[model samples]
Target: MRSAYSVETVRAAERELMARLPEGALMQRAASGLAAACAELLGRVYGSRVVLLVGSGDNGGDALYAGARLARRGAGVTALLLAPERTHPGGLAALRAAGGSAREAAGGALDGRAAEDGAVAAGVAELIRRADLVVDGIVGIGGSGGLRPAAVPLAVLARASDAVVVAVDLPSGVEADSGEVRGEAVRADATVTFGTHKPGLLIDPAREYAGATRLVDIGLRPHLPPTADLEALQHADVAALLPSPAAESDKYRRGVVGVAAGSARYPGAAVLAVSGALHGGAGAVRYVGPAGDAVIARFPETLVSAGPPSKAGRVQAWVVGPGVGDDAGVVDEVLASDVPVLVDADGLRLADRAAVRARTAPTLLTPHAGEAAALLGTSREEVEAARLPAVRELAARYGATALLKGSTTLVAGPDGGPVRVNPTGTPWLATAGSGDVLSGLAGSLLAGGLDALDAASVAAYLHGLAGRVAAGEGAPVGASEVAATVARVWRDVVGGGWAAPSAGY
Candidate 1:
């Protein structure tokens, strides 16, 4: 499993590790890793032009030290010190000794010369434009609320340049804890983080800016707590959670999933949901809804009934609301059952908050940004901007496991714990009826005896993998194709053994 910690936790761990090491040992280790990563990115360090945007923190020191290493290796390195008065003095001297150059950034204290600001800004811009690589060290994890006004132009210039931008520890200006990009922030081609993964590196908005992330071990793991603030399940992690049948297992013994979705207006939703459930490790799929005929026609093996879920035979779990439209009665009837329930789509709108909160059985709520916004009485943009807090609030409010689906699917439990972030997916998975398949798959996992959190997270992992397989070569894939490909990806995951997660999602 890949884990991520909050800024506070990472800071504490860093302090603990620093106490055991020599004064400059930790920084040297980080600088060595940073320089090695940059060398690899540059392919050849010799005769290359590299520019460092140095701030006033340790991040700036890391960049300066790394630049010194590159300079010794024959790279033409230059450091634009944004804070000349507060820059790391040792790092600057080391760079100068390694035949590197340092210049004060534009708009900073420069002998009280206002006329030089324009010329200095132009020179900095030219240096960035002509560089082969740019190292961003404008801020670190301790900084918050996005970039300061003085550093904004440097971020903008680095992005506008063709240089391969590499951030130190994190892309400056992003929230290290919440994965939020409040304002302008440095966007890197890759980020080399020290110790372990930060929460922002794994989650959205901020994740998009991080590009490819590489972790450099600095002996901080032993100091960290066992539990992480966030966790992303890998291939082997998902495979271990997948339900498998024994030799003595019968169809009834394995499990049965009940799907109560679709209406006359949207019968395809029923067929799609049933499609997902049949391949979700469930021995049998029992569908109860208005679109019974459509579901039976598509999958004759499905046990279909044109009545309330209570009359649809005994099911281990129930998936309610994909295309049920305005049918609040069916949603109510499904929620009234004793079995585990997954609420999605229109059901999320029609289901009562009180009913959901009072349920003793496990409840999972899946909602897109717009739907989540409606549930929380906020705007869609707001929910998308602060997904971590929004998802936690939803789970706490409804007393259920909340799955906020998007480019980065996040699953949060009712009580406080690590929020599982799904790291696999293709942008093509955002098709119509795609969420219905996810709802059915998660509900089936619940029927297969996985807890609400595990079921939701595992379902998301498989669903994303299937989407990637279906959308090979960047072709547009339909929702039906995605559902059909789930079983194949399941086989690949279970049979292929463990595979580490790729760089960017």
Candidate 2:
């Protein structure tokens, strides 16, 4: 599992470790790691033109020292200081001592004098354009909002260049704690993060700004706490959570999932949900809805029922609200049950807040950005911009585990532990009926004896991998294809022979 801590926690851990080490030892360690990453990105450091966007504080210090190391190795390093007076004295001296050049940025004060506007802009642009690599050290983890006005042009120029842009600790101008990009930010080809992962690196929309994140060990692990603010399950971590039947296991013993979905107008939703449930861990799927014929035609093994959910027979768990439009009564009956229930799609709107909060059994709420916005009385744009807060608030309000589905799937439990961020997923998962399939898969896991948190987390992990398999090489796939591919991924995961496809972080 990849764990992420909050900015405050990371700073505390860093401070504790720095107290035990020599005065300049911690900064030296960070500088060495940063330099090594920049060198690798350049392919050959010798004779390479390297440019560093230097700001005030330690973030700028890291880049300056790193540029000094590169200069010592025969690289042509230039430090573009955004704040000359406030720059780290030690770092600036080291760069010059190593034969690296330093100059104030265009538009910045130069020796108590300001240069011509056009000439300064051209100079800045030329430096970034000719460089082989541009290192972003304009902001650090403690910085919030977007890049300052003085540094925005540098970020813009770097983006327009052909150089491989690498961020020092995190991409400049992104919120390190909330993963929100309120204003303009740097877009890096890669980011070198030190010690533990920050929440911003794992969550989006800040995650999208940070390219491929590489963690460099600065030895801050021992001082960090055990519990993390966020966690991403790896292949081995998810494999151990998978359910497998014993020799004495039977159909009933394995568990049965009851799916109450579909309407007279939209019967396909029921079929799709049932299709996913059949392949899920549940041995038998008992479906109770108006789409009984469509489901039976598609999956002959499904147990179908009519009318109220009370007569749906014995089911260990229930999945409600795929496409049962305006059927609030059935949702109420299912929510009244003692078993774990997963509420999604139309159900998210139909499920009563008082009833959901009153339930003693586990309840999982799955909502996309639009649905979540409606539930929270906010706009879709707001929820999408700040997914972490939205998901956590949903869980706390309804007193149920909330799964916010998107490019990065997040599962937050009602009681507030580390929110699980799903690392596996392709953009192709944005197709229709994807949420219905996910609802079924998670419900089956619940019936298979996994808790609400684990069920949601494990289901998301498999669902993402299955999406990748169905859409091999970035081809388009329907929801049915994703459902059919679940078993294949399950087998591969259990056998420890699966490979994840390419996806944007």
- Candidate 1, residues 128-233, lDDT tens digits: the string is 9999999998898888998876777788888999999999999999998888889889999999999989988888899999999989989989999999999999
- lDDT score, residue 497, model 1? 41
Off by over 4 Å in 1: 108-120, 497-499
Question: How well does candidate 2 match the true structure in TM-score terms?
Answer: 0.97
Error of 1 at 489 (Å): 0.6
Model 2 over residues 1-505: C-alpha lDDT tens digits? Answer: 8889998999999999999999988888989999998888888999999999998979899999999999999999999987788899999999999999988885644543342231243377899999999999989999987887777888888999999998988999999888899888999988888888888888899988888888888999999999999999888887898878999999899999999999998898999889888877888899999999999999999999985899979999999999999999999999999999999999999988899999999999999999999989999999999999999999999999999999899999999899999988889989989888989999998888899999999999999999998999999988999999999999998888886432222
Best by TM-score: 1
Error of 2 at 168 (Å): 1.2
Clashing residue pairs found in predicted model 1 = none
Q: By TM-score, how accurate is candidate 1?
A: 0.97
Q: How badly does each model clash, as a count of residue pairs? A: 0, 0
Candidate 2 ranges with C-alpha deviation above 4 Å: 108-122, 500-505
Model 1, global lDDT: 0.91
